[model samples]
Target: MTLLFAYTSLYGQTLNYDVIRNDKSMGQTVVKRILKGDELTYHLNTKTELRVIFLFDIEYDLKETFKNGKLISGTGFNTLNGSVQKETQMALKEKFYELVIDGIRTEINETNITESVSEIYFEEPHHSKRVFSAYFGRYLNFEKVGERQYSLTSPDGTNVYTYENGICTKVKVTRDFATFEFILKPESLLAVRNKQITGKTND
Candidate 1:
């Protein structure tokens, strides 16, 4: 539900991923980052469908705008089976930050929110060790594990990110319900070739 990201450039870019579980497609996640003068904005969305006792759908959205190097505001929603599970809105105030989660509001002194989890989808966080979570309204741990790989741990779960050439190639999200894998759309197309190379069966 969270990610770690850093700004590597001022240019804009978009990234797409296929959510997969047990060699089957569950849904997709799309992320975009835009630049306008000294301000930068990012959006992240994920939609998934699965069946346990019954079929259900899940959608998650997050939006944030930053100026210079400080956060201005952010909004997010998590919906499950057509019902909202969580919602939050955060904005910068004159003295501190204000956050409202599910109609309850609070004040935060963590004023400097430059980087967050969304950036991990586009740029490599080579020097970033921690990132703020817009949803959780707190900072989380991010650790570099291997070359082009990193791990993020939070209360919900732990996630692993894999990158190639500074772009995220895949992500493994661990949840209490199940493990979800987000593979870059372009890289996911290699499944067929991989089956042939390894002589494996998806079914």
Candidate 2:
């Protein structure tokens, strides 16, 4: 899950994907990134509902701020079945991260950041570590299987991601209890941006 895109200039981009489970559309996830000055901000939002024995719904949101390739602060909110499950805030200290979860304060080392998994997608290649999990959560291990294919393993299960031109084209998650796949839409962020610019100039 390494991204090799050059980011020397400030820009804002958005990626949209369809979340599918058992070949059915379950929800959608939107990831937005904004680069300004020396700071980069990433925001992810996901919403899904499943009608099984009962109506089950979930919503998750994550916001992270990074400076010079290091995480500075982050916030997370998660809801399941229409009830709030967790709310957290985190800030990086000298050698640790101070996390406030549900109003309870705790300190964690940089090795255990909750959003570490997301970093795997944006870091440079040939680094020391290829797999990393959440600071206090699940463990994730990633291995490059092919030119554009990667295998990601976690306590929950295993998943595979295929990327093309620095954009993830497909993701397959398989677990004992559930299996899901995320497919990138044909309309990418770059295409949308170019279309908007073209429309404005023609007007």
Best model number under lDDT: 1
Per-structure clash totals for the candidates: 3, 2
lDDT of each: 0.77, 0.64
lDDT for each residue of candidate 1 in 1-203, tens digit (9 for 90 to 100):
11222232335556779999999999999887788888878899999998777888999999888898788889999999989999999999988889999999988887677777766665666544677886887878778887777888899998998766556778999998889899888643353234211111111
- Per-residue error for 185 in candidate 1, Å, reads 0.9
lDDT, residue 173, model 1? 93
Model 2 C-alpha lDDT per residue in residues 1-203, reported as the tens digit of each score: 11323332226666677889878899987777788889878787888876666777989888888787677788888899878888888788888877888888887655434335554333322212353332333335567776656777766578777665455556787878577887766686454434321111100
| Highest TM-score scorer | 1
Worst 10 residues of 1 by lDDT: 194-203
